[model samples]
Target: MTTEKCDITPNTIVGDLLRDYPELEDKLIEIAPVFNKLKNPVLRKTVAKVATLKQAAQIAGMPVAVLINKLREAVNMEQIQIEQDSEGKTIKPGWVDKGKIVIEYDASLDIENGLHPAAKVTKEITNLKEGEIYLLITPFLPAPLIKIVEEKGYKTYSEKLNENTWNTYIGKQ
Candidate 1:
């Protein structure tokens, strides 16, 4: 009887191996969580619909810092859309569409207050919109706000920031 050892080192190129041996693709997919931490966005995105930096790090079996650095590189390079408000006043952190609302995380606000002021501000912005996609940007926002936005049929997107604080955008042209 002969026994062949399988190479399962973290450094192994799982994607290349799977590509060469198509049959192993299923097995690779089965253990996707392990490969996700490999700092490969192509692999990570293919496996998970929504992968956070922490989750990616766990999948690649690497430090969070390394995964974050890689994610930053993977983000779309296209310039974000900017537009003016009804008054034509410059809106800082403005989006391309007024229908799209963004809520930034703010650590300075008191958590005991039930809801972060930024979240409230975001809610108000959402109210102003007749019908538009709402996107949220923050290192971390109060959970209650997330539910409120969802209940209103607004789309939410969480963005990972370089720092711990949150920033909000009113309107900008």
Candidate 2:
């Protein structure tokens, strides 16, 4: 079956896209396997309804334009141009030094063991020295924590490693 070209803007909701272009799901997962989260019913009921292509790109640690273009290609649409949003810190945090403190909290493991690591992570970030950074390793984007920490005045740069892993660099500026 020919999948007709569809307009997939950065603001397009994931659920809407999936309903209109089902095949694009596979292409999206191909772009970033973490998109497999779309299969989870809990997230589908919540995240998919509001998760935009731009947010998905942030979660996948890819450029918004790159992700959008990939989906556009999969749907046979002409590529569209997108300028980077200045709202986020550098996506690639090259400033992360090996000397910096790392709080490797696998939230997925915590969920399995019925524990919460957010408090512990918050403590570590609070204890950081002026020049120190906090490298938080997690199973997912840790969106809530990101917002909370940022609201507390820390700068962050998040990177997605694969389907089940992410690293968020938090600098207490």
Candidate 3:
């Protein structure tokens, strides 16, 4: 067994983790069947590189800490414990009224084309007027994208519409 060279944390990128420990692939899929998509070499290279364990956990509908600890254990690393935040209420916030949605971008097509939607989403987000909302429709919970826009001072709310559709509302604060 290889000595622990990398700390398996929520911020760890899936691709980087796999590169260091290819054996974790089955463990990831075991944690969530959704990870089976990683078997696709194209997605493995594209999405995995950009996706963090936190985002992967969100996509798997599991707690990020749980996912990280599981991966760590598989590699004989120390497990960590942290208070997991609630997934939040399903009730939409008052600022997220559908009528207030000024723009709607479905990023599933871009993802299918192996393109990241950050640039387009950021550009569209900048176009939002005060109190206006931009709706981003993606195939899964875009945790990293939400983090990016939120860091830029946008308020975001994500809701899973179905197994394959996630709606993320971005509002200018």
Candidate 4:
């Protein structure tokens, strides 16, 4: 009888990978600077500040720990600021204050208008405040979204995904 070769291709579920190799789980999340080096002008200009090390890792396709360390280095070098509370207390880096201006959108509207929901929201938010701080909340925004936000007169601190939506913080610069 001829022997049959058993298929051993690893299943790629997130949970399965995490359980099988805990070390790699963290490493898989780090992003390479090369992603930033994309030749497309749109990709090159679409920048986002991740709220958590894990997020950065996911975006970078690297390990979470590595992303954390890298972010720490960036903060130390003053390339990014470690925000604090009004009382001069060091709050967690990812935390955003409540009641901060947030933009919400209807996905249906975007689909009808040929616009991404996040981009629509950013445009509306920017119109509301010309030179002020506003926290943006959405799922995953692209270059068009950022361009709209900037044109509306706000600068972004970072872009984040929360509960299947994309978000970013903006302020007047």
The lDDT of each candidate is: 0.39, 0.75, 0.85, 0.43
lDDT of 4 by residue, 112-156 (tens): 567556645655664555433455444443434555666666555
Best by lDDT: 3
Specify the highest-TM-score model's number.
Answer: 3
- lDDT (10s digit) by residue, model 2, range 1-173: 97663369977878878888888888899999989989889887767776667768878777888899888887778898786557432335556665775554556777558775668778778877776888877776666676568778887777777878777788876
Better of 2 and 4 by lDDT: 2
lDDT of 3 by residue, 1-173 (tens): 75765678877888889988999999999989999999999888778877878678767877778889889999888899755546522345779899999899999999999999999999889989999999999998886688789889999877777888999999988
The local distance difference test score of model 2 is: 0.75
Given candidate 3, what's the lDDT at residue 5? Answer: 53
Candidate 3 segments whose C-alpha is farther than 4 A from its true place: 1-4, 86-119, 128-133, 142-159, 169-173
Backbone clashes per model, in order?
9, 0, 0, 16
Judged by TM-score relative to the true structure, which candidate is superior, 1 or 4?
Answer: 4
Candidate structures ordered by lDDT, highest first:
3, 2, 4, 1
Instruction: Extract clashing residue pairs from model 2.
Output: none
Better of 1 and 3 by lDDT: 3
TM-score of each: 0.29, 0.55, 0.67, 0.37
